[model samples]
Target: MLLASIIMHAAQPIRKERSAASIYHLLQGKRSAQTLQDAHMYGLTHLFGIYPKLSRQLFDQVAASVMNEAERYENQDIPYFEGMTYQTQTESFLYRLLLLIQLLSNHVREEKRYIPVTDNPAVKHWIKQWYRQEQHRLDDWRNAIYKELYDLLGKLPPLQAALFVDRLTGYQHIGLTPGQLAGKYNIHETDVLLYQTSTVHHLLHHAENKAAIFPYLAALTNQPVHKTRTITSTAQKTRTMLERGLTLDQIAAVRGLTENTIKDHIVEMAWLDGEELSRRFLSDTDASIILECAAGAGTKKLKQIHALLDGKYNYFQIRLALALRRGHGVEA
Candidate 1:
């Protein structure tokens, strides 16, 4: 039987489920007058899916939408007034249209939909509270993702860090496209795409559970204590070097890497360790100034933070202060 038949046979209310196709599909596209019908059958969404759970509802929605489109096209295709001068889509054209509908349905499967809500006081308060929690959760996942991608980039030979930063920051901050990045960085377009793909692959390789983040970190963090120490020794060494009063420049020289690389090691470590180390190296006076500057700048980049402070703090002090705040778990 068609999977759609099975769903009808079971006659169960379906919600979210687990499957490979997108749950976001039905939320998109032109639903027309078919939406209500689509919402009921559910199987239409999963014509090609395994709707074992929450995803079953998602698949059903898709199946309904696809079938509706097919029905609409078929009903409108030809008229029955024998000699009337009317035109209709060709059979092949209709056939191809249905194919396009199925293909396009999956186009936005990877994206997430926004919650449908309004500003009722209780609803708003609930949403705000929920957002605070989700923001923290998403932030954690984003951080882990950034770390894993960066760790892979860090392993690359000379200029890897610069390349990663330039590509990502420039694209995100400066709005540079892949083609533009190629021109700006003196590299090939293919290399840019390949690098992006490799980074994503690396991220997926360290899969926590699936999607962009949620499950992956969830799974990883579930591991034992020893497994949680995923950070590299370079960060630990940088911490020791800093504690021993080796300046960034000195540490860079000793490690045979750039000053920026050393700084990255420190900042990332600070983020990982949280505020535990902040009180040790940060004086209350400098801490206040750093936090103030961080609030004004709203960023952690050394150059950006220094500029925001109008040059009162030196490079090493700024690096430490920023790391201190980051370690202290104060995002601002």
Candidate 2:
């Protein structure tokens, strides 16, 4: 059953690679600018998924460059568009950078080639030959480019830098881009992004330590502690009420206790006899009145009973003694 459910839910979204030719076609005409810009933003969001923190750093660098450009173009005489220029330019530059990064990241994410590394002679010989021929420099090259982009973005204001990074890195948690997550999850894009970001943070922190991971996993899986505590507290309350003068029927009426269980507790505590305690307590006017008064009796009555019982007698003995003193027959 579990395997079937897992298989049924294992579906991942099919992502079509955006080819350079297709992008070039879109960029050819006047109406193509907006289409290209949208495509770039989509790619940037995906790039963040591949390397969240790194992508964010690069985004900030692009934003800083745009801000510097905006500052140069600013007209102090015309205040209306001066302040808005930086934001507009920065957004445009960020979108373009995101597209380029996405293209590179997607290629890496889809790559299937792998060469095993082992201590065996044949594998070691193969690796040495491959390295000497420089057959797989893509990893090193990609890392260098990513680092360069990040180094450039490190100049923006802390808040702007953080926001730029989050925009890209935040989609990985939900395994979807902000737009796709929002549409599929039936929530706002921002909400899906934030949740994904939070999940990443939690997973990162917990991954470092087994103790931390266990507690987090337990919480997610609904651990038994919370349920156990609730049940124990409820039982304690029920025991306390039974010890106080609340008859089983009255306790049941007030606390939603069942009649059979209440009788069992009364018998267990030796407050009433094993057989027909409910009938006797209910049918006898004097016993019923005493039980009712007991329900409202102070802790002093409990203390008195406790003192009378001491070690020589239990609660049952004290109750029998009290009944005899009051001229009430036990047989009744």
Tens digit per residue, CA lDDT, model 1, 181-231: 678777755445434433333333344334354343333222333234223
CA lDDT scores, all candidates in order: 0.42, 0.34
Per-prediction TM-score to the true structure, in the order listed = 0.28, 0.19
Q: By how many angstroms RMSD does model 1 differ from the true structure? A: 28.2
Point out where model 1 deviates above 4 Å. Answer: 1-227, 240-250, 275-282, 297-304, 325-332
Off by over 4 Å in 2: 1-91, 111-141, 169-332
lDDT of prediction 2 = 0.34
Give the C-alpha miss distance for residue 87 in model 1, angstroms. Answer: 58
